[model samples]
Target: MITYRLLHPEILAGLAAAGHGAQVLIADALYPHSTGVPAPAARVHLNLRPGLVAARDVLEVVADTVHIEAAVYMADADGGESEPVREYRGLLGSHRHGGDQEVAWSGLERTDFYAACRRPDVCMLVATGETRPYANLLLRIGVP
Candidate 1:
């Protein structure tokens, strides 16, 4: 029986196959899932409909499932931290339900973020139904 909130089989399996230093991308609906990450990366589509699922929701569950070493956000061109980025920081910074330590985090330009995702270290890509702009988050797994 499942003991945690993250019950999706594919997601669970993908995460299970990943190890420390592996990356996971939980992105908004607008993200280009098909071509964003490398070919070896496992893909899970939770985009049922507009706003059906939120990136933050996925992040919360993923954080609970894995020890996140770092979080990378897709930044705005103006180099400003968006609302979603602030919320992500608050969630990842505190010793909350999912995260036990303050995570090392940063922001990357859209292209830079996408390029980062294309790297082979990304083991999973979860495309959410979040409608908010700049709601994407990329996580690097750490030791439990």
Candidate 2:
């Protein structure tokens, strides 16, 4: 039996196969999982119910298991902004890593975020039932 917090089989498998610089997306409930991501990347749906599991909830688990070099959050193109994005940036900043391992946030447009998910480097996608707008996240794995 597994003792870790994240016991989901697909999430475990995806993390095990991922390496440094590989991208893993933790998408919000409303994000279009089917059409946004490519076919090759593993897609795990943890969104059982509305707000049952938030993006941050999944982020904490993924952060614990993987070496995260950088993180990207969706932003408003017209500068309308998002509270969740601000909170997420703060959360990532509070985490400290060893030499050459830094956690930083880069704001990407909604379209840009979608474009990035289509890249060949993306390894997996976790779709959570987070109803908050702009709650989507993209994590870049680092060397362990």
Candidate 3:
């Protein structure tokens, strides 16, 4: 009898367990979830098919549940900017906050992003079947 938009049990559990400053990774299909980030933090695979559940879709849901302090996007590994980053920035601009909260977007090097995800503070990872390059995003939860 949940009234919220997000109904996934695992996602809800992870969010509940997570504290402020904890990170949640919403990754693309190409992102290496197995070795890049360790398990036991909880992972929800919404990647039903290619382009089935996009990273943006999951981002929207996660945003609704948590107050995002900052967002990190992967820069092109080939030493250039990524289109996905542009789209992600646009989405962040349109994201609505109920109270006096703000969501900021930040860019990180591809390697740096991978390294950050390895931190022990990351609570969960959602692997979506998005095929777009550099579609991965890391969100830091803010206190309400």
TM-score ranking from best candidate downward: 1, 2, 3
- Candidate 2 segments whose C-alpha is farther than 4 A from its true place: 97-100
Each candidate: how many clashes?
A: 0, 0, 0
Error of 1 at 76 (Å): 1.3
Per-residue lDDT tens digits for candidate 1, residues 22-64, read: 9999989999999999998999999999997888888888887
Q: Which pairs, if any, clash in model 2? A: none
**Models, CA RMSD each:** 2.1, 1.7, 2.0
Compared with the true structure, what per-residue lDDT tens digits does model 3 show for residues 1-144?
Answer: 999999999999999888888889999999887866766667889999999798888888887788788888887877555877677677767564446655777778888989988888888999999999988888888876
Worst 10 residues of 2 by lDDT: 93-102
Q: Which candidate is the best by lDDT?
A: 1
Quote each prediction's TM-score: 0.93, 0.90, 0.89
**Candidate 2 Cα RMSD (Å):** 1.7
Off by over 4 Å in 1: 96-101
